[model samples]
Structure formats: C-alpha cells, structure tokens
Target: MTTVATSSPVSGARRQAAEGTLGGAPLGPAERAARGKAARARAPRRTHAEYEPAPNRADPIDVIDRQSRSRLPELVPLRYQRMTESPFRFYRGAAAIMAADLAGTPTSGIDVQLCGDAHLLNFRLLGSPERRLVFDINDFDETLPGPWEWDVKRFATSLAIAARANGFGPSQRREIVATAVSAYRTWMHRFATMTNLDVWYAHVDVDEVASRLADVLGGRGSRRLSRATSRARSRDRLRAFTKLTEVVGGERRFASDPPLLIPIDELHTGRERELLMGWLGSIVGRYSDTLSTDRRWLLAQYRLVDFARKVVGVGSVGTRCWVALLLGRDDGDPLLLQIKEAGTSVLADHLPGSEYGNQGERVVAGQRLIQASSDIFLGWQRVEGLDGQRRDFYVRQLQDWKGIADTERMNADDLTLFGRLCAATLARAHARSGDRIAIAAYLGASATFDQAVARFAEAYADQNEADHAALVEAVRTGRVSANEP
Candidate 1:
C-alpha cells in the first residue's frame, strides 16, 4: 500500500454526474506518463466475443496440469501444491479453481454476471488520510457473468472454509453457514424498499461495522472482531510501502528487489520494460476513458514515482501485478494504482455467456453494476505480450482504508454479526443484477438452502482437510515451492 491523496468533500453531485453523463477522454503515452506515475496499461483487450479459445485436453483438470507444467504464468502448480494442504486453506482458493471448473459445469436457467470469487474474506475497509473507513469487495481478477447460484454457493462455501480455518467444529461451521444464508434471505427482502440512489450510496464504515459485528458474535467472537479491525487499520498503504521499500536519494521509492516492486531504472536497462510500457499504453486506451479527455490533464498533473510486481491473494499468487505510485499537485498529493493481469474468469469454463469485448471490462462493469458504489476511477484494459500474447485488466486504487476481520480471528459473537453483515451485503449485490422479488420468492419462508449449505459445508470441510494434506506432501517432496513474498 502507498500513500493516497485525501479527497476533499468534492460534491458527490459532480462525481455522480461525471459517471455515465461525462464523455471519456483519450490520452497518448507521452502525455499520460510524462513521469509514468499512474498504473501502466498499454495492452489490447480481447472481449470474449473476440477470444479464440486455447485448446484444452479432453479432461479439464488436464488444462491445469498442462498450463501449470509450462510455467507460462507465475507458479501455478506451486499454487495448487499450496492449495492441496487443506480444503479450508484451499477453500480460500476455491474461487480460481472453482471458476475454472464452473466454466465447465452444467448450468441453471437463471444467470447474471457475477463476482466469481464472492467469499467471506473478500470484503474489507480502505481508509483515507481523513480516516474514513469504507467497506467493499476488494478483488475482481476472476470476475465474470455466470449463474447466480455460483456466487451464492461460493459465498456459502467460503463461510464454511473460514469457520474451519477458525478452528470451529462441524456443528459450529454449520451454524455459521445457516446464519449467512438466512441473513442473505432476510436482507434481500428489505432491498425492495431501497431507492436507486440509496442502493448506490449504501456503504459500511469501520466503527459502525464493528459495532454490528460485536452485537452478533458476542464474547469470544467480539474480541476477535476488535483484533481483526486493529490489524486492518495498521495495513495502511503508505505504512506497508515503507516497510517493503526503500528511499533512493530524494525519492520516496522502492529499493532494488527481485520479483517485488522493482525500480524503473533497473527495469529500463532490460528490454522487458519497453515491451511492458507498450502493452501498458494500449491497455490504457482500451480500458480507461481518461485516454480521451483527461490524458493531457493527467499527464501534466502527475509523474510516475514508483512501481513493482506484487503477489497478492491465496488464488492470485502466480499472476502478474504492478503497483504504480503517482505524485500529483505536489509530492504530498499521491495516488497508488494496482495494475494486475486479468486472466480468463474462473467461471468462464462453467457457465460461459456473452462474448465480452474484453474480459477485464466485463469485470469492471459487473463490479460497478453489482456494488452499491464503486471506485471513482475503476476501469479496464488489454495488455499485449511481445510474444503476441495478451491479457486483460481492471485497475483501481490499491487500498485507501481497506480492512477485513478474518474469520479465523473472530469470537463467536463477532462471527454472528460478521456473518449477518456479509450475508446482507451479498444480497444487496445480487439484487443489483437479478430480480430480488424472484430470488426472495425462491428463498421464501424456509431455511432449506441455509440448512443444505450447512450440510454441504461440513462435507466440504472434510474434503478440504484431505486436500491440505496433499499439499503438505507435495511441499516435502519438492514437487512445488512456496514463499511469503
């Protein structure tokens, strides 16, 4: 995380008007990156409609085996080797693999674009210098449109995974899953009353979120809530950036490092930088409206201050990611953008629909449609590899005051409240896409799905444990490698 400029109370009126109402701007490479401070995005985006599917083996699992074998992407086999360690551990990862598998699964008649990995751990609070704590879904690499059930099932399964990771027993996990399902059901019932603007305006702040969690979990769970929130606040972008990087001369920049945030000076010496820059520029034009209108304004306003290739998330471990530091207005006015490679969605293999112009754009669009409110600058792009390979991407601020209370750290009471809030929030998201009246009808009066999900969760926990053991074995045999960074 790097320091971000604190926003003044710029009218929500103007910001809202700027969305949809404002025309997009195109920016040339020289103008946008005079100092190269923003997230680099010079790649061509291939919407699903344009995608030429790579050949896969007769069996889909073979796809992972074949792809992982090539080591074309960062450490895929190693990631699975790590996932094999525990279903609970692996459950945190069900997003990617499940998405891969889901893309290949038989589907229901009903579908809406989805956040393929809508798990419990994905929600968090991002803070500003003004100390405003806003909670929202933080990851979109696996975003896609698919069966609505996929999102709900994924969210349900995540509750099970988090409970197991928290060291809760079978009975405990079941109860938590039920809590989540029921909360979702109840919340959707109320969403019908929310005005369009209200839905867009709805967001949870840290203090308010914590108090709600405290009411539900109580005792041990409540205590855990406090701990998780404290840890989250400490994860400030500037603070994390300082710990991970070093200052060279007068610049607040990163030290020379391998596979982490690397300095441009070190990169320009190698041909990869030029290739990357070209692709980044293309991605910008395809994904960002700024390329058309604000490119010159942005170019004159900011310079690239720093960048790095970062590894993030349990599932996103091996993917390519870069974080750019921008100095705007002056050195103190800063913004951090994370430019990550958006591979095909996990759900693409299962319930594929819509030939999107760009998968990354699909993600950005789905997120905005589903979320009550989205990052002001959220956008996507296509990046072309020198090898004629290309990947799509959606970009945004890395973390303003983002925080999540991990399930493992919660007390029972906090867990209950956390469960409710997450459940309700998820329902709100779903309502944004599909008809709530129908979904509410489908969930009418009974806790059957809640109960069914709980049962499925207990069974899945057993599977997770077995898988975790397999990963541990792989690590011992040198079949895969794992590292913190």
Candidate 2:
C-alpha cells in the first residue's frame, strides 16, 4: 500500500474556509479534515476490518425475500439463480445483504451521494453528450447520500472477490485492493486542489484510458483496450435497432424473447391491448414532460412503434424494465429508450430519507450529480403497474456506445489497471457531493486507511463466499427457488 502525499501548502481560500472566516460556512476544509481524523478516536480505522455479524443480524435470505416481495414474482427466481452461480455473481446481486453488513461496520461519519452499489461491474464506458466515450459509474438505481466509506468498501470487496474469480492469489488480491484505495486517495487530493469547474469537467476519457493501459501492460493491455473500444463503438442505436427489432407487415416491432423480451401486443390483446397501449401512451407523455424542452421536442418527432417488457441486470431482473421503440421519419430511422423501475435506494435504511418522494427522481438527480455527463434523454416518471401498484421509473437511451468490462476474462494485471480506473472514477463521483479537501487531508501521507480498507475487503470477500454458500444450501433444501439459465 502507498500513501498519498498532501504536503503542498493549503490555498488561501481553503485556509479561510477552515478558519470560519468564510461567510455562512459550517466548517472549513482544515477543520473538517481534523474532525474526520478525530473520528478514529471513537471508531478506530482497524475496527472496520471486522465483519462478524451481530448475534441478532437478520438472515441474508430473509433480507433478499423482503426485497423480492415488491418485484415480479415469476422473475424473482431468475435473480436468485443468477446470484447463485458464483460468489462474484452473488455479490453483484446481494446489495441488500451487504447493506445490512455495512450498517454494522465502523464509519468515518462522512456522507456523500453514493452509487450505493459501486461494485466493480457497475463501472463502465458510455457516450457523453458530445458523443465522446468516457468511463464512469454507470449504475445509480441504488444511489443515495450515505457514508462514503460504504461505497469504498463495496468497491474494494468487489475487487477482492473478482480477483479470486480471476484466479489471482491472496497477495495479488490484497495488492489490487490497496492500489485501488491508493488511487482514490491520490485523486481526491488532486480534486481538493482544483477549482469547482475543473472538478466538474474532470473525467477519464476512453482514449486516455486506452493509452494508460497500453503504457502499463504492453500488448495485452492494447488488446483489451481495443476490444472494449470496438465493442462500445459497435453498440450504437442503429446496431441496437437492427438486432432488437424486426419488420413485420410493414411495421417495425420489438422481437420476442419469452420470459425476457415479450412485446406489448404479445402480452395483451383486443380491448386489453387497446387499454394497455393507451396507458403506455400516457406513460410516455408523462416521461416526456420530465425532459428538457429541446429534448421533449426532439422526442416528439418520433412516433412510438412498439414496446416490450425487457429483463436486465443481475440485481434488477425482477424489476419492471421496458424498452420502447420509436420511428423517426421512416422505418430506417429509429430510437430506443429503456424505462427501468427505480425503487427506494438500499442506502435509505442507513441515511435520512430522500426529499424526492419519487424514487425515479431520486435516481435521476443522483445520476446527474455524480456522472460527468448523462444521456440527453434521461428523465423520470411514476406509472401504475399491471398489479395496480404505483412504480417509479427512469427513462434513457438503451445502449449508446455502452461497453461493460469483462471481469471474467481479465487476469491479475488487467484487473489491477481496471481497479485503478474505477477507483479514480469513484473518487470523482464522491467529490461531487462530499468534502474532498477534508477527505484528502484525513488520508494525508499515510497508508493507514488504505491498508485497513484492504483488510476489510478480504474479510468481506470471505463473508460473501459464506453467504453465497448459504444461498446454495437454501436452494438445495428447497427453502428458495432458483431457475437455471
């Protein structure tokens, strides 16, 4: 583990902020950093390494079941089955379980709008509004203002688990985790010294990422970089349309894939179809209102052609996700938008409830706050489900140059570079909502916090495997249902 040097002189503005000389200030950067460091008096950094559940800790299965209660019953088994495949997969889908465990861990008492589920897989490449590809935290359904350490811990634990999955030994896993934390600390230091606009514009462009990887790992790095870039470039709207839609009877409609992508007409017919389409039309109307005037006008040019119930993601399989296809000018001109269900964030249990009553709005707000650039069409709406329950949904373009990291195919060196990239991105996200100066100061010139978090990652990875085994046992004993892919 390496310590970040923060020996540079504090700026005059930071000095004023720290000394309470700044108008209407709660505290200065120095004061806050001092307070943050003093937090170790009550909660020693080493204490975070402990992951033993309290005697009365809720059963992981029961917590999962509670989350599934509001989900589509038939699709719930798929979530379980996906999670049951491996400890890494289980970790991805077990945000609720980790939330419980994180609640019992020590904290730095610093809060930030977190990705809440900042696992390694959640960080990916996407197109910015400028159509420039950038790497960022791409998942925000579980985002909320909560303990900053919680997100860091989740990210670190993910690296440990993923390293194990990639056949890296314990020493390599620990080093990878430490490197991630070190990168985060170093970036936070840089951000703390930057102007607000600079921090806002700060992002890891995909080209820069490719160059950095090539510099580090030579030929293997170049190959991975090329693969990711090519994949993202190939996933534009035109390609998605060609792959996910078909022309039938002179009309373009979503292709059917039972239990995953069922077209609206396939699911309803006659009077029911009429009512459903009418309801969907209203949903689109409401969603359009949430967008900016220009975007709304841009969307109005397209006419809705079809929609489908699309199952997506490991943790979000049971959620009500839909893809709507729209045609612009002609059959060849098309647009696709995904309306994904957004429930209360998992962090809600650990922090004060959000001011936004609608979970969709919560997700949208948090995403705009953390992501360097968001989809132009991103919006939110509340809609009534088939079960007569009201649900919140955030809408955006389905796949705009999206490229996800293939962790399963990565070796130890590949995972290391990937971890570094994600850690830096996470630091940027936290800087948007948290006191970066204070955080950087508290982490000053020492590897104490980094090593402690790495230890926690190792312990939590062990706990994750144990919980995964328990789920396996539950499936074996018929205590839970799981459907194999």
| Top candidate, metric lDDT | 2
Candidate 1: 10-residue stretch with minimal lDDT: 40-49
Give one clash count per candidate, in the order shown.
Answer: 57, 2
lDDT of 1 by residue, 202-249 (tens): 666667866765655557656665666777777765665656566678
Single out the weakest 10-residue window by summed lDDT for candidate 2.
1-10
lDDT of 2 at 307: 88
Candidate 1: residue 308 Cα off by (Å): 1.8
Count backbone clashes in candidate 1: 57
